[model samples]
Target: MVDSVVLVGCGNMGFAMLKGWLDAGMLQPGQVHVVEPTDALRERAATLGVNAVAGAAQLAAGLQPRVILVAVKPQVMGDVLPAYRRFAEHATFVSVAAGITVNFFEKHLGDKTAIIRTIPNTPAAIGKGMIVTFRNPHVGDSDAAFVDRLLKTSGAVASVDDESLIDAVTAVSGSGPAYVFHFIEGLTEAGVAAGLTRDIAGLLAMQTVYGAGALAAASADTPTTLREQVTSPNGTTAAALKVLMGGDRLKNLLTEAVHAAHQRAIELGKV
Candidate 1:
């Protein structure tokens, strides 16, 4: 029995992490096993040359995976998790299942099981994801580091000692992509209304967001400074910002939205 990585639920997010690991050469093809119940998804996983099975029962006895990544949906987690408790002895359980807390896993697995709860966004599908993780005390530094390297295949990796903060992380990064997408959609609509062709409007909206994010990542200037630099005295940009920031309308609205999402995350964890 080789040291392998067991990936559960080969959906978009799970497959993304698996692909990232393989693409980055962080894990070899044979070092991974995917337990995806869906035929279509299992077929897709096999394309990566990894061992794809319909269930854990197909795995060899005495085989122990170093990491068991649980990526199933939160609602279905209770039924899916109990099956993996056997691996708690040797595997560090890592979960990207939204709203499922580390305590929940320990309750299902064992209290001593090394558990790391993570919130990874959809951007992971394209290797631009942001993952925020909180680990239980049972997880040592080396184990946490291993999880970090595995997640970095998709994008950035960050750790939080406090598990409660994961709720805020979910609101910020986990569901954050949709907020950015909505902004892009709004910008595109504005462009279309301003007389641009549909295709041109879409291209402009997407490129602006892409370029701005890249600049923000590469530049040392603060976002506020960058905004000021773009807003000239009585310029079009300033006029737009005046409406957007005049009464802090957009800021307040976004704050409300994030808080709503955070509250919902906390509520979901209770179930």
Candidate 2:
């Protein structure tokens, strides 16, 4: 269990993580501190009984948190990160800001600061997200495990030894949700174009996507096996599979798309 934690932002993702932590009993409300400049957001955080303040300046004097989560946007991270530098001597820092590198955190906090850079999709809001972490050498084994459990409050967590792989993680999971959403949208539109009512098409599209994901997650069989199970020679599923996998067109397109996102993530992390 975490003794004390400081959350630096409480926007959509941040707030969701905080709520998950509280709900999971990771820390007591009294043991958590939230720094949110916006009045409404701070109040929302306070509603959870945590010590919510407008800024780091308002934190109780001499209070040092054991774990500090930096959830602010990358664009504003420069302005917000310095406030927590005082805790560099003690706290283990975790960042969920996309495109921000571990080196970037070292530059802002301290070269030896124990930092973990993680990418969590928006699904984390619902406790089903995928989070991939890469920790700096300064982080101890115990603290690294602590981070893994802390993130699990929001969803599943994995780790990568090589920091550079984080860029690929960003492309595959960080930006992958939008791709799924777009597929659902396209499926719904296609249904409508095929003469299904808009309402029915939307429901079918949503439920099919949700069910498929849930089944894939719960089943031990590989997705390839699942696909084969649903497909038969000259069947409708086979026809669709042919359109999607024929000459590996869809596979090539998806590979290119992930590559594009990976490259962009790398570019965004530039110092």
Across 176-256, the per-residue lDDT of candidate 2 in tens digits comes to 999999999999999999999999999999999999999999999999999999999999999998999999999999999
TM-score versus the correct structure, for each prediction:
0.96, 0.97
- The whole-model lDDT of each prediction reads 0.92, 0.93
Task: Quote the lDDT for 42 in model 1.
Answer: 96
The pairs that clash in candidate 1 are none
lDDT score for candidate 1 against the true structure: 0.92
